[model samples]
Target: MEKTKDKRREKISVATEIDRLEERRARCQDNLERAEFRSRKEKLSEKERQELIDEMAIMNERVQQLDNELKMLRGENRRNMLLSVALLAISALFYYLFYFEEDL
Candidate 1:
């Protein structure tokens, strides 16, 4: 009877160890699957990053073009203003010389 009881206890211990090993194996498999999923997610398009860079460069170039256009327009406005002032001055001088001086 004692030998039989010892054998039963040994069998139960071996069974518990097997259960523990199975649980460990399941956990390791889950971890491996999770790692593979993460690796797949990481492997995406660097093209999006490059596209963003290209878009920024194009925007910068457009801004520079607008800035240059603004500067040219401002210079043109100044020249027009100077020409108007000079014409007004010449007209005033001609009026004085032809009419006002004769009346004096």
Candidate 2:
């Protein structure tokens, strides 16, 4: 049915969005590691060091936000799965009552 197709599309979209956010988080983590290595390995002026620190802070915040978003999305996915199972069980019960009970 049309509603089923729409639900499927929404789920796929959410899954893709989650994947995109995870990839972005991975890139941010890589950047953080490189920045830390640079700070430890290179001698820089005070301004440059402070700028690096600020940049790292921003990236850290973004990573945290991404993690929160992923957690929310995963929880939503779990809820959807539970809803689908409940629906299937209800449908099966109805089918059995309507189609099989008369034969008994």
Candidate 3:
């Protein structure tokens, strides 16, 4: 009688574990189905997605063009600054050569 009771207890424990595992499996499957449904519903049409991608590409190109323009402007500014410095130096040299004689 004790042996029979032990066997019944083991069977009950195994059945409970199986039921728990089955419930978990069902929940996981339910979640997967919900996710798949949401994915299908939330997806954009191909044409609309492509249009958005194209618009982003055009904006990126425009940004690159603006960067190039800014770089050219910076280079031009540097060149102008160097030219001004050179002109100032030449003016000082000429003034010293011609006007220093008068002072002396």
Candidate 4:
């Protein structure tokens, strides 16, 4: 029971963490888009343009990292679910095969 509860807690925390990462990813993407738009505008100093490019690059990198982390978390969640199911199946088999009374 405690293990199940802990798993539930972990699942909820992972979901919350993913939500935060997704929000950060969206913000980074929006910032990159805005920077791109600014770069496309009429005129800007070379330094300003370079700064915009740099900011976009950083944000892009952050978004990619968050995406990777999210994928890893999702994969972990799936593995945990599979493991739980397998354990439950094994316990059920044990209960039926070994724990049951034999009456002939």
In order, the Cα lDDT scores of the candidates are 0.61, 0.91, 0.63, 0.83
Candidate 1: Cα lDDT at 10: 65
RMSD of each: 37.5, 6.0, 31.8, 6.5
lDDT of 2 at 102: 86
lDDT tens string, model 1, 36-94?
Answer: 55545665468754654465556455545545555665566578779989999999999
Per-model TM values vs. the true structure: 0.52, 0.82, 0.52, 0.68
Q: What's the CA error at residue 99 for candidate 1, in Å?
A: 2.1
Whichever of 1 and 2 has more TM-score, that candidate is 2
| Poorly placed runs, candidate 2 (over 4 Å) | 1-12
C-alpha lDDT of candidate 3 relative to the true structure: 0.63
Q: Rank the candidates by TM-score, best first.
A: 2, 4, 1, 3
Native-structure RMSD, model 2 = 6.0
Q: Write the per-residue lDDT of candidate 2 for residues 1-104, one digit (tens) a residue.
A: 99997787676766787888899999999999999999999999999999999999999999999999999988887888899899999999999999999898
Measured by TM-score, how close is model 3 to the native structure? 0.52
Clashing pairs in 1: none
Model 1 lDDT, residue 89, Cα = 100
List the candidate 3 regions with Cα displacement exceeding 4 Å.
1-44
Q: Residue 63 lDDT in model 4?
A: 84
Q: Find the number of clashing residue pairs for candidate 3.
A: 0
The candidate scoring highest on lDDT is 2
